[model samples]
Target: MASSQPNMERFLREWRQDALNKAQYESAIFIGDKLLAMTNDDNDAFFLAQVHFAAGNYTRAQALLAKQDLLTSNPSCRYLAAHCLIKQNNFVEALAILGEHTPTHLFATNAKRKTTRGVRAATARANSKTSSRHHDQGDDIPEEDILNRRYEASMCYLRGLCYAKQNAFDRAKEAYKDALRIDVQCFEAFSQLVKNSLMSPDEEDEFMQSLAFNSIRAPGDDPDMEDEPADYVQMLYQTQLSKYHNPQAFNTAIESLSTHYGLENNADILLAKADLLYTQCRFKDALAITESILMDDKYNFAVYPIHLACLYELRKTNVLFLIAHELADTHPDEPCTWLAVGVYYFTTGKIADARRYFSKASMMDANFGPAWIGFAHTFAAEGEHDQAVTAYSTAARLFTGTHLPQVFLGMQNHAMNNMTAAEEFLKTAYSLCKTDPLLLNEMGIVLYHQDRLKEAVKMFASALKIAAETDSDPHAWLGARTNLGHALRRLRKYDEALEEFDQVLRDGGKDAQIFCAKGLIYLDKERPEEAVQVLHEALAIHPQDPIATELLNKALEESAEAGDIGLLGTADAAFGGETSEEGGMSGDLASFEQRLGEKKFAARMKLARGRRTAAEMPGQSGGVKDKGKGVARSGRRGAVGGTRLFRGDQEGVDSMELSD
Candidate 1:
């Protein structure tokens, strides 16, 4: 019998590895069970339990581990048992098995190594003491740790999972932090903290610094540490966090991972690269990366949402509709599919349908944040500010990790003219993310409204600079340039402000607001003749724009008073020929006459000579259209340029018109 034992055990062990590798778990479990039944050896039982665990037979695996004396005498067995419970989603039972506390000292770090005899002896003594007190600190161990030194971090991580599942986010955040403290290489903990936005930017920075990376290192890393000033591993960890000012470092980190680890094509690395591009506001490039990833692995759901967002941001209505249709047909079960559908409806102007689909997407997966944000966005688009705020507020609470919800909240509040509330939410979001150009633009808008001209200019300039450096999407960052011009105009920097506004026109080609902005600069410069010309261009594009029309009247009055008839040539031939040095991107006065109707058009022309400029005002303040631009767009908050409702009501453009 003893002679047969060696051959039988060896055969079973070899067969176990092959079967497990093939995921032929049923056959492996059957064969392993037979061997265990015949021998009843502790080693056989342990080997069988692992097979059961791998097969997701958690109850049976736990039972097998418990049946052997190994459960009581071995830390590995106890950890395995706890893991089985966790796999079964019996988090409470899992926590009970894991215990409530980790020791003061960190342990089981750099487990990719053999343990020295001294380490084993010390662990044995500690185990003995732990056994005597009926206290087991080891829990849910990964098989990689040969001596299970990482059990302390593992315990905290598992507890965090339990707390998060139970909606105890505050406790979960702490538990996750503790896991990182215990093991600086504990990526699970770090990912949880970052993915959930559990820590504010400062808190994350402080936490990263506080990690004990140098406390324990593998032998191979000793030489590298001695030669290098910075910890290579720490730099790698930093790469996994939010991207920022140091583009070179970010590039180097990715290169190291790609070259040293040969993970260039790895899904995680690719996803990280795509995410960085998206954050940089380079949606098209990000979309391309995501597309390449999906081409290789169509089921890579991780990249789907970003792809949809890029499409939406680019206003690829046709592509979005086609993709939405396909996803609805082929990937109906995915929440992202419905989100795509919702976005399609949104872009196509079916607000009600968009709302329904967004709700459906959210209901499909409560944790899918974009759906919640989309649902809130539907309300915001329709001017349902209160409902939008409430929905965004809920999303903010539910997703404590993302700054998007807070951004939307601030925007909604700003739109409603709740300046204080807007500032508070924006500040909080700023603490979380300092580099998002859209967020910075929003901050600048609020400051502009608060009459903090200097601060607002600084914010706008920062936003424009960052956006310009990271992305070449002129349409995307045009708002920042326009807002900067607004601020510069307020600061009486006419030339600088005019240059900014001119740049917006040159880059984006034509924006009525940009023309109106230039008109404001001209007005500020007291060059009312030039202002009248630009304001004519603005009115040509948006005939009834309160700001454009009122500014035109103001310009005309000033021009008539100053007798600057360059733009107002001879009344008989005024606006008859092509406007030279008179109109800009709004085309010539002929097309303007065609669009604005000859009656109102003639009135404005007559008014340029200072004859009843106010009587023929283009549009009233209440008639201002929300073209999704404007600074004071919230009903009657007063248009951009002043409180004298452009009457033709002064067009109030809310500077906070963030496209994102």
Candidate 2:
């Protein structure tokens, strides 16, 4: 009989790639089913179970593997069954399955190996077939030793994963180390270590570099294989870990992997690349890549949020709404899907709709930070400042690892005119995330308001430096430049201030605010002609801006005074006793305080200086008389009409008088 062994081996090889190629995967599934029917053996059953597990059909795989007899079936099949159980989140059952198979000498060699008289079996079966291949061969190594080692490594790796799932980090680390001791090339354990932040950046870089120089086989060994290819996900995960700490190394590593595997054909790798691009603010490129992925699989939830973000940044409002709706339909219960839709609504000024969607997301997952932030934004837009602060605080507490909540809190305070509070929050945020340019710019604004000109200049300079580094993000760079110009102008650095303003104008040539700042500097320097020109340009861009108009009037007055100026020989009008209310930054707060005091004075006089009157009644028999010289005369008391009178009598008469 022609055995189906070779075809089965090929099936396992292609199946293990897990490339997510529809045609290849379907083909492998068909071939595996055919092999299972033809052979109906333990190896065939195990292969089919693996095929199911790799395709994310964990329940079906677990059922088939549980049908095997524990005493005679291969131990690897039991281990794989445990893995499937873990994938299904049945950790207790998985641990039980793992307990049934120990990597002992008796267990490895006695269960499946044919025995003849126990001791006189000098020669093994001529060509005994096994489940898979192994590349490691040395005269000094015994076959049983290799088998036991592989079993031990596999056992420890799974145990570590279980502990990690249970959040037992220390125990997980020990278990991973045990796996590494048995099999030095266990990439899964190493990847987990890096993910858990147990390894430093240098150690991770060294580990990745070592992979290129060493001949490391993957966890499983194929006996017919001459060389094993690098696992695709492992390479991609490593690249992700390296991207933030060492971007150059990340690029180099990815380029090397692409040369070998051609990552363009893989969706997962494409997503990773797009994520890296997004982080670097190459939004347009990221959008293109993400859209391509969607073409193949529109239901890929992992890429949907990123695609939504790219569309929002590009101002593709219609496309953004269409995709957001599609995502909601695809994943109705997903918190991220709702968050994406809510953020889209928030961006387009549909605040009530945004709040409704954000509340839905928060209800779905109470711990979701972005949804809570969206809730805060809705409250802020509605002028409910206190509610906004509360929601933002909750998000900040829930997501302590990120700086976004604090940054937004600071911005909210700034908008409410709470400068000191805004500065404090921004300082804390900067301590947490030192490289954020937005925080730096806001801090500078606060300092400028406080008249800390020198320190404000430093803050703006730092923000500009950081913002300039992100060349792909033009808004950040432009905002920082404008802030720098304002700060320098305040410091009397006319030339430098003009240069900054000119740089912004050249970059866009449309910002009225930049032109306003330039005109202000020209006014300060007595360059009235130039000031008038730029101020008019600013008014043309933004008609009748208050600051621009004021500065332009001052410039025109200075020009007229310099040409045909005449000191007033006589006042055209005498000043009234009343002073005009103080205006501008120099006197606004003082004038407000004065107005507050005048209102308080009026209220106090109304309460303390009340008027009273006393009337004289000629028809009355008697009444109390006024004592003008601090002397009082008591009159006889008498009853007039069923009431006691203070000073009344039938015979004696007194007069009553009003006094002031």
Candidate that would win on lDDT: 1
For residues 531-586, write the lDDT of model 1, one tens digit per residue.
88998898888887865786688777767855745544342233233322312212
Off by over 4 Å in 1: 39-43, 69-75, 107-146, 212-236, 259-261, 325-333, 356-366, 469-474, 543-547, 564-660
How high is the CA lDDT of each candidate model?
Answer: 0.62, 0.54
- Please provide, for model 2 over 1-660, each residue's C-alpha lDDT reduced to its tens digit, 9 standing for 90 to 100: 367777866665466445335535556666777766766777767777777887888887888877755313555776688888898888777777666233333211112212111111102212433434332332236656666566566767787777666756567766765565455456677545543333333444544443321123334555432222323433454554422234454555466566655765477566656655544446688789979998998777556545655565566778868867877887888976886788677657677897898799778955444466567767665555678778767755543333445655765675466878878877776755565455566677667666677887798788667555643354425655666676677566879989988986776746666676777666555566798999999899999676577667876876676456442121121111322222122232224334544654565346324421111111110111211100000000000000000010000111111000
Badly placed stretches (over 4 Å) of model 2 are 1-235, 242-246, 362-376, 383-401, 416-434, 446-451, 565-660
- Per-candidate TM vs. native? 0.75, 0.58
Q: What TM-score quantifies how close candidate 1 is to the native fold?
A: 0.75
What is the clash count for each candidate, in the order shown? 20, 4
